[model samples]
Target: MSEQNASAAVNIDITRIMEMIPHRYPILLVDRILEFVPNERAVGLKNVTFNEPHFQGHFPRFPVMPGVLIVEAMAQTAAIMVVQTLGKEAEGKLVYFMTIDEARFRKPVVPGDSLHIHVQKTKQRGPVWKFKGEAMVGDTLCAEAEFSAMIMDN
Candidate 1:
């Protein structure tokens, strides 16, 4: 890890994450943030389990985590970075997806997997920010995407 990343590494639990973004259970994909670099980047984790609602209807025999939700996890990671960058005043503010590009699902994510989400800021213009994100299971890349979003008040 670079000096910046090493200096910024900090643990953010679900409660703090909830205070930063407006997502709740079922929709709140990120379980914890392992590393955060304010405006630069963030690394988060999502523990995939069989109890999630989508698994029941998605595929009972082979419950694969939806690709879209993985992307959403990436977005949520980016949102946390945004909020951290902007400070306490930005808490509870909403981050809305403006675009998702070059999304690719390389491997299927299943229950009992620990999905690690990594997101880095690519650009920023006022409230709008662009990011590149990757979802990984151990060393294997499960999904990746480039996306942009805007922060707004409630």
Candidate 2:
């Protein structure tokens, strides 16, 4: 994708998202990319449900989405943006988390909640990129964090 095209709003479905990232099955937290602006930012959506594997062990009577998983969803959103910015050549590359700072969980995310993950690039050098992300359910802020990741050939 060119700079011109990158600037335009883009919607990525589950199939395309699968091609860009390696996460799958129960771990593929992001269900779709609602909007993507290459190097700038991306907004992804995850539809939480009771059928998720974690809910069985996380809490049987009162299921709640794990905080760590929420952060992972944010990271996944960032990774998708990174891959889109780098183009097809970087597809299937591995993005490993280097650091997670100032992470906070404000509200419990339950099943039926639509998690909107907003991630913006803060800094980038070589293959390492820093991002600030927020997980929101409608207008409610559920969680947020600042993190960095290194993208490398798989």
TM-score of structure candidate 2: 0.94
Residue pairs with clashing backbones, model 2: none
Cα-based TM-score, every candidate: 0.96, 0.94
Candidate number of the best TM-score:
1
Q: Residue by residue across 30-97, what tens digits does model 1's lDDT show?
A: 99999888779999999999999999988899999999999999999999999998999999889999
Clashing pairs in 1: none
lDDT of 1: 0.95
Worst 10 residues of 1 by lDDT: 1-10
lDDT comparing candidate 2 with the true structure: 0.95
- Candidate 2 lDDT over 1-154, as tens digits, reads 8765464556799999999999999899999999887689999999999999999988999999999999999999999999999999999899999999999999999999999999999999999999999999999999999999999999
Model 2 — which ten-residue stretch has the worst lDDT?
A: 2-11
